[model samples]
Target: MKRTEVSFDIETIPLTIRQFINGATIYDSSCSEHAKTLFVSGSERAFLKISKRGTLEREYHMTKFLHQHNVAPNAIAYESDLDYDYLFTEAVSGEDGTAELHLENPRKLACVFGEYLKMLHSLPIEGCPYGNRTHELLNDAQINGIDLNMLNEFSYSAIDNVVIHGDYCLPNIIMDHFSFKGFIDLGYGGVGDRHYDIYWGIWTLNYNLKTDTYRDIFLDAYGRSNIDDDGLNYFTKLNKLTD
Candidate 1:
């Protein structure tokens, strides 16, 4: 991969010993055409996230949208460059869901994740303007010479128009201890099939843990029965091939 260097100044923030332990070096390598990086300064306790996208306009729009809906990290500061089309924002405190949770019970974690998905799916999708991820995924498979027979076996039964985080994996979910704090990576966020998000969530766990027990927990919490097992199997197989 070609690395793009961003010309910018580093801003320092105060932190304690505990904060120093948890901070990480944050970078923004989002756009395909341009490279932008955000260097977050702090320890693991608390830090900031500076991002550079393809355009500052898009980032501003997204930031405003997330803030209006109360769905994004706190925006403490921002800067834009018209010539470079770069934008930056502060990072929020919390660990991605992919990190181990301190839950006394695994089932409880699944239930909490299920409920979180439900809440996300409940968001109104009338004016969503993002890409259709299901179509994109299927298209990418074809373009990459991946077999879609597995995906074809699944049924698109429920096409509920809901706001879906295009990348619905554990890493995108942030948690404070065992409780859900918020979500990240909204660049691909938009309205789409509820199953698209649900299926991916289950698939991620199955891939990482090589178990289906958590899948059942999520389904039960969603208050639904009779998931298209064949469909899930197909999508999972397709995901493996493409991934």
Candidate 2:
């Protein structure tokens, strides 16, 4: 109820959309402390997210960019009104990677997760607006009320950057049966170091599966040669400050 008050004031939604969603089955799908996400199902399937004003601007733009690349959902609308930001998007058709089917087969799940991450990293960053994530991450960590000493001060200048799903966790990955459908919850996605994504990919698998058994399998599937142990470790430390 507090989330409804703080993030989503139902009256803030446009009238036509509000009427439709009021009649549809609405499910609370929030996963972060910063926002509220709702899944609406009925005549049309869609997701509506609300957060503090101006907070969803980047997600709106990033989703639009990735949609052009065929890897994200189409962003339908974005509006900032009455101290809240609202974003509407058509839903990607599939269950997330954490679904029982994917969870039952760890080996297959790890492979698909690794392979698809590799594919996302291979995307061209030519028109990406969020290419300065490394610099931004450092700055964000320093001033975001987190202890600066907790962050790794490693120089990432020499590493090649790629289009990364900033939050490359299993829940953000959608799978239709065993195949990768698309990605969701891409608020932090953009051009960044590959190891950052790899770090999350490995972490998510271990966290979701409740074991570290698939770490090497995931790395190998993502092309072991491209992985840098030091980079992954650096990101592991850096993530604490951001999280």
Candidate 3:
């Protein structure tokens, strides 16, 4: 699998809009044009994640941290000139779960992904320095020009302990034929509640496969027989307030 998969030690080249718009192969899961990914040199060897100028810097910091921790792809370069933060990372050696072919065994895939989140949550949160309480999240949103109502009455406190994936979705996970390889798109990940990732994980499986068939199987595989409905609902409602 490693030999067959395209990999690269990509050079330090500043990605340009022309290359992104013209020659690069775009990823299907792109949230938007600014949030899109470009396979810069083709062959899936390298890709550049381009985002608006000043939204955040956690991807650069967190990707490098997780890569060093042997949980993500190695970042090739991170450039922020004026506007737009471009993150260049080497392609991981596997098919992302978003690939249509990998959808063959959605049950196994859900279980494996659930286990990955469990492993991620087991990691200690000590020294980790991202994510925040609801107030902090709302504050940051306001700073970023997001209009959010004052939800101060809500108990928006930190429920820290487990490390969360932030966006615990299908595409963020990389797997080498049912074996977990690494994680991607981890800007929002840090110390947080495990149930949050679990909720999102289940959501993603249901969403991506267009079925809720394996939600219970996924939770069972994660060894959580009793789900945290409160935390799940909490994060869901919080996302509505802030996003």
Candidate 4:
């Protein structure tokens, strides 16, 4: 693999740390092409993620906060330069849900996701902070001149809000031998409508497995006797427009 040299202004660098950065393997794991994640293995494995300056603090603070809640990795190192932000965190040790072991048994894997997600959503939101509301996100997108083109506002009064993994897809979830470990790519996570997560989870399964065969099974496993078709369709359309 070709290495992308990431340069920053530093007052000093010890020889050992400089060499470690050079030897680390850059991972092409993120679905977002703009952000870069590198996996470094030594005494312990850690992941270093770098992204543009705009999201520097939001991701750093959220990941750190989630770690405090024991649902994500500890934020081991963090720094920001004029152009980019760097965050190093302990790796969530596991194979992702896409691993063939899980793929061979899709129903079981979906059950794992279902149960784990239920636990995540139940985390108390009282004093827990730092999440972007869906309304605010849509407003920000419109302000930036994105073509929303007649998306109707959904009633918050009707929808139940829960802690959501803003991008709750298979790849972002880590699994160890079909057992749930933890979550990754939590930059968009926070209190939001349950449908936001359900939409993405189903979409991700459809996307990765190259079929929609398992969508209903996933919902059943997640313990919903009836599907929320209205909520799912609304959020899916909204996401496509804003995304």
Candidate 5:
């Protein structure tokens, strides 16, 4: 299957803010043309996420699945049109957990984040209908003219299947202090090997910190003594070749 190139944006809808705030104000932030996120609060807080081309539907379904399993934030409402999709969910307290990590001790943050990934990987996957993504990703890479031999070195080993946040990065995590509150951006959520999450966790840490030490700390906290050298090699090669 050909992968669709999707983009994201966020926008604020014209909703009365006075009912919720003593001095109600509206703040809207857009990351891109197709994605917009709105924060509204005075007494009550909620987030309005708008996306184009059915992105919200995919995210909504994934969020609902996680909520059903008692994972994180609960969905409030969702609506869509031919051109846009909207999802409203209870706002998580605190800012992006990554922001906190960057300013303070990242090693400790890595430990906490590592444990969260382990817990996430422990979720049951017997009933999930998603495809085995390790294979699927490799397949997609190959179809896109990615080198197979360079990709095969990755562990690709199937640990007990569990739900994977396909894009498990720090910014996607919401937390207060060291305590993980919830997760967002589930467009790629599905069942897969634990390494899929682990691999990306390391990748994200490396990307965020511009250092490899935190990656080691994360692996240690994750109880992994040795990195999946093969997997890392393949993914590194894959990352370079794809770019």
Candidate 6:
């Protein structure tokens, strides 16, 4: 996540959050156009995200759920008014995977990336509330008026269902010197096909590092025996339509 120093009008902020970050350093930590994320560094470190009301409900709940499993930052508070939603979360320790320190060593980055993904997939999903993401994605694409005839032609091969970090990109996976810390931006996370996360893992490495050389290494580290080529292709096409 990028954190360029920025400022906010204290008077315009909601009273609840305004009090939370009083006299704190603020930075624009947002990566998405739909929301404004401000990082606060005062006596307490926290992130406050402001977005259209009702838009942050899933992320708020998901963050709290993942925190119980010790894989995400603790959600501090969530509030909504007539105009917007505010979600505050404690800062997780460590830099995002895109930090120069991690990106410098592509080999180790890919290995740890794959290893951590496997660790996430190993998590039990007995109580996860969002377990129908594949159908939801297809439905959302249709709702957005994107044609899905191509996706209709192929059958997605089955894999053991496991917990998935819906957007498992380098920036969302936090780490400290190659050790896993936590995952953020979990609006899309839940019980889903493992290949969806794998597809993103491969995509992020290639997109951020500007090379596809580590795709095989990542797959190997994650264990090739568990992967299905057809499943990867299925999600690739699905993502294109959804995007």
Best by TM-score: 6
lDDT of 4: 0.69
**Per-residue lDDT tens digits of candidate 5, residues 99-208?**
84443877877777788888787777765546476667666777898767755556654443678888788888877777777888777777765666777888878777
Off by over 4 Å in 2: 1-10, 15-22, 144-160, 241-243
lDDT of each: 0.57, 0.81, 0.69, 0.69, 0.67, 0.87
TM-score of each: 0.65, 0.87, 0.75, 0.81, 0.78, 0.92
Candidate 2's TM-score:
0.87
lDDT of 6 at 234: 82
Local error of candidate 4 at 24, Å? 6.8
Model 1 stretches with alpha carbons more than 4 Å out: 1-64, 74-87, 100-105, 147-150, 157-160, 207-210, 225-231
| Residues 52-119, model 3: lDDT tens digits | 87543787777777777688888767777676777777778787787766788888888888788777
Model 1 lDDT, full chain set: 0.57
Q: Write the per-residue lDDT of candidate 1 for residues 1-243, one digit (tens) a residue.
A: 112334333433222222432434544334333444453544432223333435444444454455556666644444443334333444555666655552345576677778888877776665565546567667777899986664555564434366777667766677777577766656566665666677878876665556778888887786585345655565557667877
* Two-way TM-score contest, 2 vs 6, winner: 6
lDDT of 2 at 17: 59
CA lDDT, candidate 5, residue 204: 79
Better of 1 and 3 by TM-score: 3
Error of 4 at 6 (Å): 12
Question: Deviation in angstroms for 9 in model 5?
Answer: 16
Candidate 3 error regions (>4 Å): 1-31, 42-44, 131-135, 138-158, 225-227, 240-243
lDDT (Cα, 0-100) at 86 in candidate 1: 32
